[model samples]
Target: MLDTAALKEFLQQQLPANLELLKSMVEINSFTTNKDGVSRLGKMTAEAFAPFGFNADFVPSLHPDYGDHLVMTRKGTGTKVIGLISHLDTVFPPEEEIKNNFQWRVAGDKIYGPGTEDIKGGTTMIHLVLTALQKFAPDVFEEITWVILLNSSEEVMSHDFGKLCIERLGADALAALVFEAGARTGNAFSLVTARKGRAVYRISVEGRAAHAGSHHERGANAIVQLSETIQKVAALTDYSKQLTFNVATVTGGTVINRVPHFATAEGELRTFEREIYNCGIEKLLALSGKGSVCSAEDGHPSEVKIEVTQESPPWPRNNGTDRLFSIFSEVSSELGLRVVREERGGISDGNFICHVMPVLDGLGPNGDNGHCSEQSADGSKEQEYIDVTSIIPKAALNTLAILRLAQSA
Candidate 1:
């Protein structure tokens, strides 16, 4: 019974203002470690969310340097609760933003900035959609409980604190929506019902060092041992199971003349199936033998250590998740929008919340070019961007989706 026309009209009317707000947000470098900047953005967001009947409260994280977590709630009359999850942090450091001359640029349909696509746009749209609903569709808005968790350090999922916020806020909720940006292409929205879990680890190898000319053969060659280990680890990835292993970083050999005494590799594991995911984790941990056969020349064992640095469980699909997607997809068809049900290889805070309750993700702007802080292979400064045209419609879609879910519940 919600008025779709009025919702779309309200969004269209406020598009320019919302874009301006996005520009302001993207300009502030809220890198995970930039605690002060994240807090400032959080405060500004709380102020912006106030007019929509949301009571904003700041929850301190386990550490002060990671910035404070934000939870905003709007009371309603219904029994069911719907949660909106988003993050304020970007991958770009403050220095990188300035070095790359990161600024919101309007070019045809694209809005170019550092955090525009990664999720700053998503955060902006969340506030805009709710504000529009309160003005044009109060009945639907006031019918169900609303819990908005604006977290910091999602790029890092830092210390499980972001997950902690979701656990705290959505413990009583029926469903949740994550405002992460959509696909790597096109403007049609994608509803993510499932995501791959990830585990990051640092592997180190220690070996005997010796001079290259005097006693090169005496050294165990840590770099060589690490190379073999990286290959074995990479081979563990199975495409059919949607499991992938990547060695993201490697460090070894300080100088050309000497066999290095220490070498290390940092890598990640991503998979969708929990059992398969756990098996891989166990295997990875087992690779950390105190002494492993690292070299075949002399059959000498080397000390290899693998320590998990971070982890996030996969967001598996369930009956409730399927039902939520059906509701959202129906609303999308009604709005003349094409929405594809997607299972993502990348994990988000949704993965954490899905453990407790079903969740819908990727309800943000659509564009590619995210997760960039490095130059392209061609050496041009790679920029992150999002489709400006996608914003209003996505905001509209999210607004209608929430209202319909709330009203029906």
Candidate 2:
């Protein structure tokens, strides 16, 4: 039912062109905040898909800095609707240093560039794969409904655009394929079927201020209370349950001479289980509700509040997820590509789609150092890159996987 040989040959023939397309994508600094660059990339993407009869429209971003979401739809009479999700935004901002911003380059067997492996490669391959399928395998392409959501704000989290896009399209989706960099290879599961959810909180404390030199005893030190609270809050992280809590920022008090009246601590919570995540939240809220000893005889006061800033649910490895991975693995093995499974703590839009359908993530080309900007002092080398050799191999694998999925439907 699938033509693995023809698909491999098509991918091989299109490798050069796809690489150039990825180069252009990496060169365009579509940072989450660069509205202009993001919109420009969206236009370019729309133009690319237009030749294939995809009707593209820009969905206004809930926030201005994140640009807009690109939704492309193609008519098909298939049994189920298939969703392809990827993001165009990179973590590197536009005003950042040239070395840190978007700059495409070829070094040895790898492509050294920002967003190269993180997802530009994935997005490029999806375009190429779909394009090829539409041309060489028209029957397979016409057998299923296709919805493509190219998000522009994944790096800084959804900022509501991804949510709205999913709410709009996910209701009809039976399955989704996320084009993120796979974590590892040469293993049995090689696919990302599960990821941890993330929850962010801002814990604040308030206390009476007083002059440090004259009335230290009269002053209620909010900073000191917050400092002790940070430890108590961080202590809740349970590694056995794979729950983590980290205090990322703490701020209070302007001048050292005065006792601080207000202080705040920001932290993140991650977990692979929703129940565990909720348990941690309850503990954090309870901890934040009670303050440390200050000036009162009651010792700890009740001037604390914990607010959930944002959250993303964990995507568990379930039967449906395993089925998707199995299909992809069979196709990949047939194509002679490495296979491995990754269970990561990082969450993605795939986590959201799991609510409606089984989803697969990190199907991008094999590479490492994603979202890492670590560099030498002289800025000559980069910490991020995508293996040039794996580009078409993985893309070909995805092509076959899609064919298999369509056949099943």
- Tens digits of lDDT, candidate 1, 239-279: 99888899999999889999787899998999988998999
Question: 122 in model 1: Cα distance from truth in Å?
Answer: 1.0
How far residue 136's Cα lies from its native spot in candidate 1, in Å, is: 3.8
Q: Return model 1's CA RMSD, one decimal.
A: 2.9
Tens-digit per-residue lDDT, 224-251, candidate 2: 8888888888899899999999999989
Candidate 2: segments with Cα more than 4 A from true spot: 97-102, 168-172, 184-189, 296-302, 377-381
lDDT of 1 at 187: 41
How accurate locally, in lDDT, is each candidate? 0.81, 0.79
Indicate which candidate wins on TM-score.
2
Error of 2 at 181 (Å): 1.2
